[model samples]
Target: MMSRPLATALRDATLLGAALLDVFVHVTSDEPLRMAVALAAASLLLLRRRLPLLTFLLTLPSVLLSDAIFASLAALYTLATITRRRTLLAVCAMAYTLSDMTRWTPSPHLDLWNPSALITLGYTAATAAAPVFLGQLVQARRDLSLRLTEISQARDHERRLSAQAVLAEERAQLAREMHDVVSHQVSLIAVRAGALQVATQDAEAKQAAATIRRLSVQTLNELRHMVNVLRGSHNRPTELTPQPSLTDLRRLIDTSGIDTELTTDLPGDLPPTLQRAVYRTIQEALTNVRKHAPGATADVRACFEGDTVRVTISNTAPTRPALPLPSAHYGLIALHQRAALLGGTVTCGPTPDGGYRLRLELPVKQEP
Candidate 1:
């Protein structure tokens, strides 16, 4: 079935054709004029959309040669439809409206004072003025709605652009953190271990060298994870990967290059964020312990109180003076910020009992 708009246009075209054909049959006194009227009337529908203003202007010639009521009205509506130039339409409507109005005349039958004449006059004025005013109102509303829709689409596009820009900025920032924290620390561990492998003739030094190499690999693995997280695109769960958790504290203790012991009162299931935090805190403290307090015994204790988790790492006094990692240690700071982002606090200091100590406290988010 034809849609409503197409069906309506077809009906109007047929009616316009009939009305113009009737007037054409009455008006032409000769074959030549008759042929022209038939061509113009039939062509009006086809030309109305293609040449709206031209169609309206062409109908003026018909007003003198023809008296087709519906054809003239259709031309008026066409003028209103594709009207880019409103001034011409306004002028034509005004001229016709005024012409249709009555003026007082000498003959009583033809005078504007006649009630029948007045009604016909009013009808003409209304015909001309009503279509013009209604057309203008409809056109104004259409133009306004079109402008509003365009503005709304532009705002939506801007929001998408803004979101993309912010994501790019975040990825760049995270990349910098990974390079600064994870890369530098891992590189130092590799270099130090390599140096120790060549220099130390003692079995103790050889063992520490092996531990450093293991820690360096662990650092590189964690760094890869950090990079993946920054990308924020993956089908697999991040938790599936080896995450340095409080459970991993024992592993870190083994790398401390000292006698190590651990006691845990941690929950069986830990939130990934808090677990990761506890892991890094232990890792950083042990890295420091390996660098400063070589051969010193260390104790690791982790306990959860209510919905909060904490880790305490304390090592015997430095055999040599305690030093920060040879290169920049970005992991500690990144860990600090990570803990803070997850509503937690991190503290590192020297123990009163001649030992280096670090502590981390993180709030747990329980599944409801």
Candidate 2:
């Protein structure tokens, strides 16, 4: 690609050569002086981009003296393209008008009605208007193209940010799921192994059970470390805190500012994984209530109906104004994904009494 200065120099040199040829061909008298003046005016075109006003002013005398048309028009065009300032444009117009008026020789019988005089005036007006008008159009186009490029760049940046945000959210959800599912199962394994280690009579069987219990505990610790690494700095304090089972529900309610009532008909020895899921579901629902409907009373109920367990948490509208909080609105989505993974489903929506309700139902027995 050619550099801009070199390209401009070549263009100006071509226009100058053409203007010199036109002057030499058309005007016959004072060949030496006219050629010198025309050459000087054309040379000024080389500086038009850097010093347009000065070049335009300097070329006016040459245009008037030898009618260096191309050089004069190029200077005017450069001036208009570089600046939209009315004062500068007006100065350029005045200089050109003065040059045209002074250069024209009035006929011996000159009058307002003289055909030659009228023609010269019209030609002068065209010379002044045409180049400047063309230059203004070019300037407008350049400005519009620059604005379009900036707007396109801004939109691309926004798209990249949105994609990063989505990826981060997905990673967080994966971390949460790993913590909920793997941790619960490992804890249950450790508990069962511990019970077996105590109950068994044979020394070999007891040692095997003890090994299983120790490995299960080690696996749970490794799983937590992996989750912490994946979560990075965006993980909440709750994520790092110890997992709470259904038995901790009362303690959770006591810490919450809102009035909450919990009623459970769940069996005491339910699978630990199912208990963890129920606890997480209720926890998420209560968090939503605290965030979206602050000061609202909530009711949490867990019941066993045959082979299924249903956990429902519902909250009334806030008695006080809701607090302002930034929410990603993906909590329910993560909950639904968790339920689906456990061969269950979660339903959430506004209650009939102008409140919110979230219900999670899981099978009594879920494959490990």
Instruction: Provide the TM-score for each candidate, comma-separated.
Output: 0.47, 0.54
lDDT tens per residue, model 2, 8-81:
77887787778777677655666676677777887887788899989888888776776666778888998999
Which segments of model 2 are wrong by more than 4 Å? Answer: 1-9, 26-31, 104-119, 194-215, 229-368
Reference-based TM-score, model 2:
0.54
Write candidate 1's Cα lDDT for 169-215 as tens digits: 78768867887886888888888897898889999788779777777
Candidate 1 segments exceeding 4 Å error: 1-201, 217-241, 290-297, 323-333, 354-356, 365-367
Residue-pair clashes per prediction, in order, are: 0, 0
Sequence-dependent TM-score of model 1: 0.47
**By summed lDDT, which 10 consecutive residues of candidate 2 come out lowest?**
103-112
List RMSD in Å for every model shown. 14.0, 17.8
Instruction: State how far residue 277 of model 1 sits from its true place (Å).
Output: 2.3
User: Ten residues in a row with the worst lDDT in model 1?
Assistant: 99-108
Whole-model Cα lDDT of every candidate shown, in order? 0.70, 0.82
